[model samples]
Target chain A: MAETTWRPASARGAGGATATTRAWRVWSSAAIVTAVVLAVLVVPPVVNLDEQAVHLADKLLPPSWEHPFGTDDVGRDLLVRCVYGLRVSLLVGIVAAVVATVVGTAVGALAAACGGWVDRIVMRLVDVFASVPHLLLGIFIVAMFRPGVWPVVISVGLTHWLSTARIVRAEVLSLRSRPYVDAAISGGASRWRVTVRHLLPGVLPQAGLAAVLMVPHAIWHESALSFLGLGLPTHQASLGTLVQGARSSLLAGDWWPTLFPGLFIIVPTLAIAGLAGAWRERINPRRRSELML
Target chain B: MLELRSVTAGYDRRDPVVRDVHLTVAPGEAVGLLGPSGCGKSTLARVAALLHRPDRGQVVIDGEVARGWRHRAPRAQRTAFGVVFQQPRLSADPRLTLTQLIAEPLRATGRAAEVPGRVADLARTVGLGDDLLARRPHEVSDGQLQRACLARALVLDPRWLICDEMTAMLDASTTAALVAAVEGYRARTGAGLLAVGHDKVLLERWCDRTVHWDELSGDAAADRTT
Candidate 1:
């Protein structure tokens, strides 16, 4: 291995993989979809909505030709407020989801693969987290840390990964029993090779599904935290804070402020969760077929 | 040479499947192990093949204790032995084709550039034709999958081969063909073989010497005759 840096044999074109379809799913096929998801995700942060432009003269206007969603209290455009709120929500969702999934998958793989006290301890920790209310934990995390994107990300990301970890642990447990892993290890293939080649390819689909599902959870958590003033500061408007701020106007019958931002939150949460199912089917070869999307 | 000294291994702590077993396969020699269905010969082969960690006992290979299990053996040590299981389809990765499967050890040894040629050569040696190389595990029959698994096992040109019930699922005709392939491989490479099988005639025919699982164990009253 010293004289020549080892390349994985598949890279040598020995198998002619493209010539036929194999049992495992191909991740690269999702490049088009993931790219589109990324593009839409990138849009929220870059497209500034000038949410802070307050016009006292144009205060409390209803949805009209000038403002599609109308103006909010203190005369900020509801469209701008909802959009900037979406920006913060997406940032928190994406970042927190990634961190949670990566950590969860790694921990789950280790706990299940190692098996014994390590497995017991990890599962017990998961149980502990499960027993506690996620909202309470998220609140505690935000309050303990500085109020910013990181805190929201950490709170939402950290609390939400238990499901992913549990899911991966179960999958890895079954995968460990599969003869291919044993064959690979027994054939003197290094543990790393067995893990990277055999184990992870199997675990990734479920883990990925969890990560996608986590986005909505993170977004919701961030919004909720911001509602309680534990999420992003009042100066930086997120979906949660925007909705929270509109609570007063809601009772006054000026419902546009609450209604518009709330739609932004609900619509995205539903869309992401719905899309997660299709994403799951597309990535798993056994389930891959003409999805009626 | 491969040696097992009182090697005992089991999945459960209360009941050891293979206990206090002693066996050896000399260099360039073919040996056969036969027993009833549940006599623990497969576990013994697994231990000798450096796949299973023994509870107590040592596996000495070519005068050194084979450093496998926890600490990895050197590249030379790793390439010195090949182990094949009874269920070829189960052992082989369904995701990979025969070519990629056969080329795994070569890839591990940093000789990935030689994989295509090596895969073809191994295919010929194992009686797996060139066209079967592109097919997945499910695409082939049990016989063909066995041949692919055998080719993969021998790809590293291992000095020793451990085949545990390798032909149990094959038809009589396929078994004959597989035997010929094993024989051909041995003739060319002079590799040692430890083959376990249910067929007494095949074992007797292929191996230089045949030993029963009872003979290797410490049990005094194992009265079954072969």
Candidate 2:
């Protein structure tokens, strides 16, 4: 046993203050929240076909302000539809990613903590699921369930959960080895208590970053499936549906309908990707330390 | 009193770190376990603290086999013995503040309501003030964290404090101060202590009697008394 050394209050306080400041710099909690809020607010009101009005009569008109994004053969507002489509696409992406992260993290934590046969079984199942291409798996699931929001959400969520599960499992495995975990055990903490209080908190920052990164991935997959006419029901307007409808007219010199919606999708996608990059930089200690110097 | 009757235990099955060893610490006695680095001092400490089960013989406390009392012991009985590790980092959670770390044993036994006063008292005794109590483990110096760990070990006022190389990481002055603090506590409460260390000088100065594992193993047939 070693003798306990006392540190002066001021020195200890300074150390704690420095650590907290560093943590705040690394996280930028406010910036993340603001990005999320901006995404929520800005993407919904942008309409693509507002400039072209009389093109409603022209059926499929070329790009012109009268129906700024031109007109579909059905005389619909491509701009309005694109704006609404952005909302739907973002909604599906976020919902699917969140569901996947939650379910995946829970299953992964359980498998890692309980280990032995349970761990082996869970990992084998994860491997089986991971071996299949997620897009193909999602398409198969959507086909089986019939196309709808929930089905697409579930399909993408279930298919993409392998990555999240793997990340969480690795984190939990490492956390279990720390001496504080042993200390918690010696203090008569139940397995569940240790997992929830110690293990989960340690892994949460990483999981959160992973969850954010998965959003764009899920969105892209969903869009691709929808563009192929496999996602989002017939009446619903997603960016993929808009793109699917506009593909036939691209050759007729009517690029406004597709171009406008594509820009809308790309802009948000890039923004989200940027935010994810920033978040990773903040949460990762190695990166944060580099920035500090 | 805690006793080990020819206990054998180790991380692996084949190579027992603590060989067949018999030792005892009577009630209210401060005994130091002295040995070299590879002599299994910590393993023996773990056995006494019930953190590990010996592969052979019995860990007997108060004339009864301790295995039977494992989960059946009362809360106070469980807290009657506290073990501190060589690394203070290992003893305390890095995420916890000094106050939380020191108050952990109290909270563990459902005595959280008594934490505020007890924490303040322990901090004062260990020379950790209000400011240090608010900081997390990594934020504080190693010496300060070790002091917090010591305070945590004593919060429940355990009868047997098993410290395994507890002062090995500290500077000389800090170690000396801690030694004096332990001595003061022992004088005041008359609690039994099992301080394990490789430093013979520390053992001689801090403990009433020194017990070496080699000596215990060398003369197994002799009825040894310390």
Candidate 3:
């Protein structure tokens, strides 16, 4: 008898989401899978090609079957360099995002759970952090350390955690007000127990969503730092380094070098963002019905 | 015994909802708290349950004054009473199965080993089918979920029970089932109860005595007789 009452709206074909959202979800999932597969399987072998092996004879080669993304001014394979650059950018972005998410979730949960002067102090700290432009702060932090992956990751991770903290704090505050949480408290669960068992689990998905969404931003932050010559050393083939190296070639009218690396950065960023959007839609109870379609 | 002594409480301390309310329920007694909607009956109920701290006045349990509210409350004091809120859906962890939800307090208090047995026993008592034990709140009807909530409230064998408009959202059959379940638990445990709602006939039928909100607060008697 209960079964008859819970026929999901999607099952009844009466959900609110339109075909456009449905299409977007499909495309987003596909893009994410394709990007991950490329990063894992294809990029590794492509990156093995000698990025610094210059061939003056083959300099500024345009897109051809022999040199797909064309050769750079140093005559090194642009395709190989771009693939290597993408791998580095993804590695930094993912690591930095994870760091930011962990810090944010902890801060957010602590601030909310304590809920007094602690909440106020933490929120004020978050505001202080948010007031600074991420890029500007990131540049200063990165400039302090040696030009490498760790410095860029640290800068991006530190600079980007404010939003996730704010998001997580908001989520925790709302969850705390929930009757279930109140019920848990009334049930003799200690403050620590309620936090660990109920509050943490409740905020995890929102934190995860925040983490996924932050990946593209982290990537962009890393790329910007690298472009400003304050990130990864020029010897390393990050997407930003490749773009920076292509400035001269671009001026000489060999646009392929700059364009290809730029494309590499944009495509994966959009793909990750798309995946995050689809994930957000899936977790939302109202939109979850739409996913079945 | 459960007692609220001259309790004045609300979301805002300065502008209290229920002022200087005094009420009590001895063991084995069922007291209905009758009030119109927005009369602060629910807020008073929360105070009685120790889920909310009154702006003023004491909540005495079994002649002992209650000191803390929520998780800070002593385990013996906190676990002595079980509260069933109005919305079973909102009062339940949506992700947990019915069995898990019913067994929550047991696990919360480090009695994990007793969960399966207690949950099974309560399920049977609440008339929850074996098949329904594995379902989430969204999978069940409001009535079915309320049954689970009743089972949960009684699972710990609490000395006191507070049902704050628990049946307000349910159909007649479900409400009767829940009331009967509460009655069975009370009969077995001799637990005191504070049933808060505006349903006069239902309260009159289920509770030993019904008290008006204004009467409890010592206000000038209004036309609150149902």
True contacts kept of each: 0.37, 0.21, 0.79
Error (Å) of candidate 2 at residue A117 is: 3.1
For candidate 1, write residues A139-160 as lDDT tens digits: 9988998888998898888888
lDDT of 3 by residue, A181-262 (tens): 8788777788888888888898899899889888888888888889888999987988888888899888889899899989
RMSD values, in order shown: 11.1, 9.1, 6.0
Arrange candidates by TM-score, descending: 3, 1, 2
lDDT string for model 3 (B120-156, tens) is: 9999888999999999999999889989988988888
Per-candidate Cα lDDT values, in order, are 0.79, 0.76, 0.85
Model 3 clash pairs are none
Candidate 1, residue B176: lDDT? 86
lDDT of 3 at A245: 84
TM-score of each: 0.80, 0.79, 0.90
For model 2, residues B22-121, the per-residue Cα lDDT tens digits are 8889888889998889878887887787766678868877776775322334445556676667898766766778888877767766788999999998
lDDT (Cα, tens digit) per residue for candidate 1, span B62-92: 8999766532556566557677789987888
